[model samples]
Target: MNVKLILSTFLFGGLIIFNVNALPASLIERDGDTSLGTWQIVGESGVNAMHAFLVSARKVVFVDKLEGNALKRPDGISAISAEYDLDKNEARPLSIYTNTFCSAGAWLGNGTLVEAGGDNGDANFRSGRQTVRVYDQSIGDWYELEGIMPSMRWYPTMLSLPSGNVLVVGGSKAATGINKEAINNPTYTYYPPSGTVMEDYPLQFLAETLPNNLYPMVHVMPNFEGKPIIFLHANQRSISFDLGSGKVVFEYPKLPGAFRNYPLTGTSVILPLSSIDNYNARFMICGGNKAYEITSEGEASCGILDLMAENAEWEMNDFGGTPRVMPDATFLVDGTILFVNGARTGFAGYRKGGGANALWVNENPVLFPVLYDSYAKTFKPLASSIVPRMYHSVSTLVPDGTVLVTGSNPQGGVSLNVKYPTEYRVEIFSPPYLFSNTPRPNIISLQTFEINKERIKVYYQQIVTLIVQVAGGEPSFKASLIHHGFITHSQNMGQRFVWLDVVNVWMDTTVTDQYIVTVLLPPNSNIIAPGPSFIYLMNYDAPAYSGVEVLLNEQPA
Candidate 1:
């Protein structure tokens, strides 16, 4: 017998809301989990935004933002000893240095912090020299080194080489951050004109090209052979550069979409706890505003890029349902990427308005955790939090596998006509499955189809596979073919199975007994849709929800 078609439905007030809208898409909680606790209020500095680096000894070294050019700037390096209890969430500040502008820096194995920019108290630009400042944490002092690139700089990026040397790349010196022709998408009107492109000025073209105002994000791939490589997004171009010899190793590769929407920042770290195989160490970039009006919404979206390969080629897949900018991201132990504080599209005037009204105003801001499945090439938005923020600091709590997230808009500040208090608030993100006793997954979407219709086929895009997984019990599922355009009652009975896979066959799972299962495609129907089949998972008393997801396999199906 064919399986009786079941469509997941929701209830409102006193009526049943049949979910024809929520099909084929679902989110389930994994048994694994982790968290980052807000333990200590290490001495605070002026409100600032920056990324932190984890040392071999687990020590975290970062530069404190000092008052510079009237804007919160990095004056010197600070060390945070790792003695803080990961469990108790207790922390203490080690030391902080004075006036220094380090657009970027990294820690060498020998205990010295190699910083780009200059030693004099100024932005990477005023110093007019891209030299390395070596700071010894043991003595709380810094020494300057000349003989590197000579000229003023800004937006400098640096990385520690395996040989104890540091690789610094990309920064411009013109009054505007980028070259004249390198204007950001005209939509980001708030960008300071001079800060936009800093290529040529009244003086000699400082160094070489002007500051692209772009991040030359550096990462040492597990297979990197002593060479320093960085993935850079120049405007919308994805290019890879070798820092050792200061040259563009690879020109550019096309992305699924433009890179302007979500620009790359900070460094890439390998996710240690996910079941991900092919992209064992996935590189992530998040929260940059997209070029406006170029697309349907006149807004952009958030996306991630896979940086595992050696070639300059890359792929961008959207995740954040809306556009976000200047947000910080960290990898969780379970392989999930924690996208902390960022601005949602509605809050546009906050940073891009080019006026006093450009501060973020998110009353009751929602923190939406984003999870990326590399194997699946899809993104899911997890539960929300109460942190409304943009340009905040986020780091991984490696020992306990939690993320240490802190700093965002404080109280009593207004942006775009919205007011927020400068916040010293910090919190932890623990997956619900591990922390909550009643792990229940929410139903997100559902869809139904005919078995034999000229157009109702699943193989339209070479997709002939149906995959499903039951969270707690066996999944008793079913499907039926339609005669011409008419529907039929069909049911398939079998022993309980946690998962199900069938080739060119109308099938279902024992939802009440299974955890998960996927549909397998037949080689013959590569370009044709599979016969319509009504799918159902046995309803459970214990909230067993399901939804559909489009898995865009990297390779052609």
Candidate 2:
């Protein structure tokens, strides 16, 4: 990739700059200290089927059922507020709001939340109506907005435009109920001449302008230039809505190679322009079931589509792993798309137990398929989650770069109790490490440093010293020491960089894989008690990405 080309059209404020310098896989983690990994359990009941939204201010929020029976008030879908720590290896919880059993919701920029179709007792209360909820973060509560649709909807597509307007599209509204009218009647939500607006806005909107009667998939374009486009997978149609003027552009491109079932809705991600072609914008869609077995492999469809040019269409492509539907895909800071936790086959259910054509079983393994845009044609099998997850909510990169993954079917949802479990638990992947997972030998045992009060001379030594300290994963000793505080001068060398574990300096001069190095304390040195000093004795190996060993005084044996 050209550096000039990369810097020219940077997104999110040039947060990621392409450099000619090669990146080492081991140290590939995002910008944060690996030592401070933190995660707080926000909801305790196993939340398996939930959705997440990122606030305009970059806060991550989601709604999930509480613990116990899958259906219950207060236990229904609630709002969870969290902040990410770029340096720490974890996420800390801020607040949670609950009022309905929401299946999906989206951030309306200014901390407002727009949710569609959730169960709220009486079976016909909202009647599949589209409800908008505004949450005040400062107060940690929720306010119900007045405009209620006549029908009920679940898992509908909702997006907030850059212009601060909100767009709600097709979803499975109740087949019958009070809100059912909302779904049956599209004119109530769209603009005049097309549809009527129930709520008063600074501007008048038409319902027909929206993708009425369709559960559209809305994704914001990268570089923050284009308006939010809604892909009505239900009708195999796509529409671009310009909120500025309340206009809609239509494009009907039948995806080639497969006949999609009733619900064409699938997950779509904005891939880098270079992934599919040298020119124009490209996106990857995955996890939709087909009525007919189209491919020879019986694998579901996985392909790329060009969204920037005219007559945009889907092009078949290679998949690094098994076909997953409703999988949660997130864009890694390194330009990699990570797909985790999704069902193997169809919408029917989990593919567990012994079956001739099981989509996935325990032995089949639930793995993390990482698609590196740099390696567009190939998908790499990365580490799997500690637990198997399906229909889960995975968060995009926080400012710190760690992915926050939560919720999922505990075990294929085979057990009745396991269905749609809510998860207060979450996990994060530390950035990749440069070195393979090989245990480093304790060649240099003295991994600690301290100051003595007798003070005239500084003393340092290692508990175990090996002859080949600078070999293989051994530390090297060049006698370079760094002190965080204090000063060094001729009368008393200013605080100098010193290593206590480094034993000797004599070693192979040619080898560069220095892992650890130790050194002895200088003579006649004034010692500062409680003040810590660090000495690094290594051949010349660059710092490991993480899991760095730091020696501290009075710490342990």
Candidate 3:
């Protein structure tokens, strides 16, 4: 757990410090007791949340299907969404004219949430299947852009590229029907329409995946040879696509078992990249079900891939105790993965009749959240939630250490008569790190702050100095830049975490109760893609984070 920073002069102008120590080895193991955290019902969301994203440190926006009866404001406008303030524990209705059902979103470099695609609705004007909406946090309102997507996307995925543009990929052309071979839109296109529309960029792998391929897990990986390569997963197949030239680079081995998209939902995360390994990237996916097994139990299998290897192959692991389908696998600030929500049996969606397990056969919700340690390949159970998060549930890591968990609408509508009724209540889960007795590091100021601009911009390979006040012993600080991607259908697109290197750490001689830490930004855009990321400072304990916008400048100044 002890990390020592070694400074060395390199050919380049800036100092090249190596972080030889591995991430705290203690995080690899866990105690026998499962009660390591606490969960509390924070507030009730007025609308059934189908989609949710963090807008800021203290605010979150929730979107739902445009069912006729939407949450209304005082002026009687149909509010399709609501914004919840974490500080006040209050929810206020935000008017959304479009149907955002099954939509996907990613944050732009300027901190705007660029949401794309949706359901067709009841053939109404508000049906926003091809609409592109942007939510500006400063104004606290939604703006429907004049530009629309080339095709209708129901369960699409969006990822922010290092070039500061959003890439829209893989969704059904229609809204209501199940994902059929003919209805799948396997191609991808950029937002703001990339000039010539290259229709049907033949991705045959998508069609082969069939009904379970909706909302394929996608990640904009580190640039390979200066060209951006995207990793796409549907069913068990993993393929790499070259964004620059728009061609399939290569296809890796199929995942061990079970499909990991839509009805057969599981979850995935791009394992944290470390400087020690030259920032090599790895991807891990866990928990799902067989597509045809409507009432069959979920799978406990997990698959990992080292993308940078010469011949990358998926290594399968089954360390988790119970089976879980549609679970939300989120990466914590301290470089660990957390699995929450989902069911133990059956696939996604609610069944009407035919048997006891029918009418939402996916019962037995996994109450406790499990933590996966990539270092030791172990699983540790954490605190459980009172509310059952099913088909349309979401869990997002907020600026503070706690995770905001909410939403579960198994049935078509909000009906209490069903086995798993619609859920609107929100709960927050605090990890054990948040409850530690160690004093948290306070970031008094950043060296890159400019008086003219409201927010600071930390360029690539830039050395950022922080003035901190540590209450505990000598602080062993680690910086994690995380983008909490769009959470829906057990998939988080563009979600990644990278451990920043600490160049120097020393106590300030002039000031009392203060210290100075110099951290290096990612070397290039390939390591950490450009966009809005939460820079979390982890000292002796898991401390809160502040938002920093990243740009794609590769050259170091």
Candidate 4:
């Protein structure tokens, strides 16, 4: 331990206040070279990024389970959360009083980040099964309220409802290899919950999809008959539930795969929406074990469906010749999907029970990433990484076009010496667009250092003009909005992307290489649920170096 680091940490309020390493050296020297869709090891994280969410363009918040990590709390306990700096590649500790293992989170419509649920913790680790923690990016700390959740949840999915509150669904009481009837918590609840025992609504779909039904996939579909519906996929089944009456409205065709959730996990994402298609949503789920019989090989195919159609059915396709389990599906600014992390064999979770797969459920870390182009309807292999981002790993698309990847611990706790030890490295993947010399657009009008405070507010059926500039010359541009939501367990709950209708674009006489781009916002709140999101400009297929944050239907604070 560096003596300077010890001097940085001292007893304050009977707790240890650990300051920043300020400039911890990265194991790899980032030459700042543009490899074009390459991976770069930037820095290490204070906590394993089992769960993470981008707080701002320059900052990310990483949370893990109460394991034996290297960073400690103000009280000399293992730190399970930290604020990661994307610009300086530095990490600073954030105070978290509860266990966040296998938890769920979402950004409220008001732009507050809320976290919920976790498993029982050790003596030092407080029970987080029913806690709710909200993050203030400005303060860089978590304010937790224990026993606030209606139920004890371990792997529930947290999604933002149309009304601005978060809906936490699914998960179990205990950490079981596969869900069992006794421990299965097949229900959903709200953040500022209704004051009643009946606040937690029962969802029979969860109980029916037993065994491998942890972190059940749920996405808010477009409004149907003036009410919102959520699509839930678990095991091999999929269904649409009406939020108004709490009933399964439609049963879509079943997905053809072994299991799409934990223990053998794949990943799912809602494709980019556009007015040309009336914002008709299409969802895709890719990579997992193909069948129950095959445990060592991952599912080589993907399933997609037009979820809002009257006669919706799943269409399957190959996973670009790659087999993956626990892969992270991230939506990029250029309307392409990037699948990274996970392994080629086995399931999620670490070595547990007595079995051949007990040593580590997963194997052969899928080092290479696959890119899915929705327009071309094809998958392409991209550059590979030297690290194995297997179980508990997560990848997040930052404000910058690059993807920040972190975490991979296949153990009960932090272990340094193992085939796949707990990983603290934070790497960035630059997409191929960055490598090309193609001109990229910059959102010059979006000038804000503060988060939602300075965000451009978009309402229903509104048209907004963004001043975009390109160095090479004036070029055609398109607009898109992405809300990455909370990234964990490959779900990235509440994550959505929409194509903003570019009504008009014309060169600006006042500024060279600058254009006034007018874009039509989503027609209604259903098109983009209320919350903080990112607005991106694309010069053909190349996205701007970074995106600017915007508030979608977020009321004044």
Which structure among the candidates has the greatest TM-score? 4
Quote each prediction's TM-score. 0.50, 0.54, 0.89, 0.90
Q: Per-prediction RMSD in angstroms? A: 18.2, 18.0, 5.0, 11.4
> Each candidate's lDDT (Cα)?
0.34, 0.37, 0.74, 0.80
Ranking by lDDT: 4, 3, 2, 1
Displacement of the residue 161 alpha carbon in candidate 2, Å? 0.5
Task: At residue 415, give the lDDT of candidate 4.
Answer: 80
* Residue-level lDDT tens digits of model 2 in 1-557: 11111122212211222232432234233454423233333333233325554332134444443323232335343223333333342334433333234334443323245554444433323322455565564554445543365445443455433333445544444432112334432321321112454432221122332222233445443222333333333324445544445455555465554322112224555453221232234556555545322221222566676666677766776445576544556554334556555545443222344344433321222446454453446666665555545433454433233455665543333244332333445565533421223222223333332221111122322233222222243222222223221100000001112223233333334444323222433221112111223332222323211111222222224
Give the total clashing residue pairs for model 2.
66
Model 3, poorest ten-residue lDDT window? 9-18
lDDT of 2: 0.37
lDDT of 3 by residue, 310-427 (tens): 8998888883788999899888878788899999988777656533455665778999899888888888998888899988899988867778899898766666555676787899
Backbone Cα, N, C clashes tallied per candidate: 82, 66, 2, 4
**Span of ten consecutive residues with least summed lDDT in model 4:** 1-10
Which candidate do you rate higher for TM-score, 1 or 3?
Answer: 3
What TM-score does model 1 achieve against the real structure? 0.50
